[model samples]
Target: MPSCQPLNRMKKVLTAQAEAEKIRRIGEAEAGSIEAIGKAEAEKMRLKAEAYQHYGEAAKTALVLEALPKIAGKVAAPLAQTSEIVILSRDGSRVTGEVNRLLAELPVSVNALTGVDLMKIPFLQKMTNPQA
Candidate 1:
């Protein structure tokens, strides 16, 4: 019976050691997955940063140009909801022309807000003035 007790104790010790080794392996695997995820995220950010650096102001201008109509729509959204409007003017005035003028002013507004002068962009300059 005394010898049997020692064998049982040995078996318990081996079981505990096996459990500890399993836990260590799981911890190491979890750490490796976390490291891989971190590396992938870092790589994604690095690529994005490089792309932004490469695109530079051209991307900004394109984004602004793309967004201009949306911005104008937002600015004029309240007016769109109006059922009717009465304007009294001594001179002949057209609301349509006023709306067009307001839309035209968006680039200037964008320039003021973002400090990215749409007029300065070569493509925009070419668009505005073909001779220049």
Candidate 2:
């Protein structure tokens, strides 16, 4: 053989260089994909916010009414997952009281979160004071 050693070394160097180039290309493709996904998500959020801004008070009230049950479901989800609830007191009334308090707090929490006073709404006002 003329010089098989030099040929083998050169082949190894070429293979390593090709692998490095492939890795760099893959990294750049992944970065581009990530950037595109981020931009898409940002655009979606912007459009959603714009749509929300277009909603009238009546639509917003309807939206809140629809959301109330979902919010209650979320609040009650933890209890659903639990096998049993332990009451430290002699009677289980404490637990019932707490549950009642949580239900009572929902409207206050919703008002604080949405800036819509649930009490002032005409529908709720009529429901609360039906004679009026």
Candidate 3:
């Protein structure tokens, strides 16, 4: 019975060691998952930059065109809730002018905010005038 006591104590110690190793492995897996997520995000950004460099201004212009509809929808979203919009001016030109003004200002506002004038960019300049 005394010899059995030592054997039982040794089994308990081994079991405890195994549990500690399992917990450490789980923690390492969770840490690895977090690191993998960060790496994936960085990879996505790198691909986007590579695409921009490869496609140049044409790609930028295409992206702008694709975004225009979404941007227009957002810009006009406020009017969606309006029950009625009363134009004080008798002339119909006021409504046309307002719509035109909003459309015209969209590009200007985007340029001002982003500080990226596509026209002035070297890629765009080269694209517009091949001789340059």
Mark the regions of model 3 whose C-alpha exceeds 4 Å error after superposition: 1-27, 113-132
* Candidate 1, superposed: residue stretches over 4 Å from native: 1-3, 61-132
Give the clash count for model 2. Answer: 0
Candidate 2 lDDT by residue in tens digits, 33-77? 999999999999999899989998878888888888898799889
| Top TM-score prediction, candidate number | 2
lDDT per residue (tens digit) for residues 1-132 in model 3: 357888899999999999999999999999999999999999999999887888866567667767767987998899999999767888889889998897656657767755446566567568656877
Error of 3 at 122 (Å): 18
Instruction: State, as a TM-score between 0 and 1, how close model 2 is to the true structure.
Output: 0.75
**Model 1 lDDT vs. the true structure?**
0.85
Runs off by more than 4 Å, candidate 2: 86-101
Q: How far does residue 52 in candidate 3 sit from its true spot (Å)?
A: 0.6
Local distance difference test values of all predictions, in order: 0.85, 0.87, 0.79
TM-score, prediction 1: 0.48
- What lDDT is reached at residue 95 by model 2? 80
Better candidate number, 1 or 2, judged by lDDT: 2
Q: What's each prediction's TM-score? A: 0.48, 0.75, 0.56
Candidate 3: RMSD to truth: 7.0
lDDT top scorer: 2
Candidate 3's displacement at residue 128, Å, is 18
Candidates 2 and 3, the one with greater TM-score:
2
